[model samples]
Target: MVTKTIEVVNAQGIHMRPAGMLVAEMKKFPNCNVTLKCGEKTAKATAVMQIMASGIKCGSKVEITAEGENEQAALDKAAELFETGFGE
Candidate 1:
């Protein structure tokens, strides 16, 4: 397993829109299993509702973890999304 810490750079955080986008991206990596944690909340990366429910606002610390065949790539991509503010 591998993990990366990133901040939510978007002003609105991971609302429904970005949650949907993130979940979509996560779903593409079938060989990798990923999860996201913010504060006391943790959610499977493939679950849009759970991700949005994480209540990760701007500047919030997010821990992303991935394991399996594509763990490295998956973690890297997920971290990039957080760094980019989910494309704002």
Candidate 2:
């Protein structure tokens, strides 16, 4: 498993749109299992509502984790998205 911590840089934080985008990305890799956590909340990466519920505002640190055959790639992609603020 791999985990990377990053901060959200978008002004909107983790509203529905960005959350959906992140879920879509997470869903693209079936070979890997990905999860996210912020503060006291933990959720599967593809769980849109759970992710949104994390209340990960701009600058909030989030941890993205991945495991399985494609863990490294999955973690890299997820980290990229978070680091880019989901391409705000």
Candidate 3:
């Protein structure tokens, strides 16, 4: 298992558009389960609704985890998205 932390730099945070994108990306890594946590709230990265429901605003602290064969790649990619601020 590997974990990464990134700040939500997007002005709107992980809204529907980005949430959908993130979930879509996560779905590609079937061997790993991606988990996202914002502050005290955590949600499965595969669930778009749950991620959106987390209400992670701009500058929120996000932690992501990937566990499995490609955990490292998964975590790195997920962190990249966060660094992009979900493309906001």
Query: What does candidate 1's lDDT look like per residue over 5-48, in tens digits?
Result: 88888998889988888888888899888999899999999998
Per-candidate TM equals: 0.95, 0.93, 0.95
Candidate 1 segments exceeding 4 Å error: none
Q: Least lDDT summed over 10 consecutive residues: which range in candidate 2? A: 79-88
Error (Å) of candidate 2 at residue 7 is 0.9
Query: Per-residue error at 21 for model 3, in Å?
Result: 0.6
* Total backbone collisions for each predicted model: 0, 0, 0
Ranking by lDDT: 3, 1, 2
User: What do the candidate models score in CA lDDT, each in turn?
Assistant: 0.89, 0.87, 0.89
Q: Model 3 over residues 1-88: C-alpha lDDT tens digits? A: 8998889888887889889989999989988999998888999999989999999998888889899879998899899988977666
RMSD of each: 0.8, 1.0, 0.9
TM-score of 2: 0.93
Better of 1 and 3 by TM-score: 1
Local distance difference test, candidate 2 = 0.87
